[model samples]
Target: MREQASYLRIADDLRRRIAGQKWASGEQLPSRAALAREFGVSGAIIRRAQEALITDGVLEGRAGSGTYVAEQRKRCRMVRFQATGQAGAGYRGPDLGVLGEGETWEGRSDVMTPAPAEIAARLGVDEGAYCVRTAYEHLVDDKPVYLTTSWEPYDVTKGSLVVLPDGGPLAGAGVVRRMAELGISVTRTQERSEPGTTNAEEANLLGVQRGTPCTRIERTFYSDDGRAVETADIIVPSVLCEIVYELPVSRS
Candidate 1:
């Protein structure tokens, strides 16, 4: 069996303490040395514990200031598949119940881009094969909510008006319809999601702490003929949005 680390044990205790109102939201925590003495551990261990909390969004660390309890936030629900129901638009905005139809997104697509090893594998293309790469930032009232980077194999859409995921006759038109215009019917999509931490660039884009908790989704669209037409990586900040998948239920 895998064992929990020393700092993780302390972090659990700290979480309990916060739940009991040991420090109110936005309230600074004790110094590292003080917490170390209280826990009978070294200062370094205390620092690790606090850092873990910060990464989990329970604590905030200021450059010169000490750690503090993070303020509680009401995260909005983001439902998948709802975006596909939208009509006329090439790019489908998210289905945030709170944001409603007010959400706006902008994207830039680059043609003939070389696919990285990871993305190429998802698209079933060789490394460095040409593909169309597009990046999107979804927002509500100008506040960034989430980000997506998509890759589509060039050979699939080449010579077609839908080559550019965001810049064709069906611009903003999602992958399924765009491929349909090229006689390629998208049959299904597969997604794998897991918890992650925001890096420096993602932190800046989402306006959150460097190590803030996030949801990372690796999604791919498949054609009826068993070909991967497009793949994307989506990043959602945990503090601002909650990821919920609404699977279809058969009433029969």
Candidate 2:
């Protein structure tokens, strides 16, 4: 509707263009001033549209340069691992819940980034080494619900489908899922969840005001021999997920 907010209108128009393939991967987008005139809105409104595209991974803007269309791919999908109750089947096929579309899993090159001291200690790896990092962000109805970063030894993950260069269903499926397939079944799961404030990137993606309160869920998965295989930092907006627990009481 014309009465809609200017930012929303600009975003809607750009969405249509991207969906229609008007811009291809690596294609440059019009300058802000140009877009403003096209939409009959101010540059501020144009900036809003660009921000939305960047968050959605449809476009990437380079500082001092121009914006370019990002490669199109299935960025996000439903990954449901049932913890208990009727949902206890585990993260199988899609259709777990409405994890509104976007990059559910993002694969990056096999580059080494120095792990935080805590992460290095947990993984038992040197601070600097070839590590394959895969990042994942999940959304429910187009808003960020979960964010995770996973690291695997380069020798273990190289030549594997860790990074979706061609952009297909997220390989690794998730560390646990892939590990189980490779005969490395997880025997124990440790989780430490607490409340915290959302960071700048998460705040923008989740559509929450910056520094909004959020829940931080840290999980470390181990094999039977006490080998730590994977570590994940899961940032979850409480509004989208609820944690329920069941405790058995001792009989008197």
Best by lDDT: 1
Best by the TM-score measure = 1
List per-prediction Cα lDDT, in the order shown: 0.79, 0.61
Q: Pairs clashing in candidate 1? A: 90-172, 90-173, 91-172, 91-173
Q: Give a tens-digit lDDT track for model 2, residues 80-137.
A: 3433112334333111233433424333433565666777776777776555555665
Candidate 2: lDDT over CA atoms?
0.61
lDDT of 1 by residue, 153-230 (tens): 999989988787768577766787788898888887888989998898987677577877898989888888999988
Q: Report how far off residue 102 is in candidate 1 (Å).
A: 2.0
Candidate 2 all-Cα RMSD? 10.0
Native-to-model Cα distance after best TM-score fit, residue 128 in candidate 2, in Å:
1.8
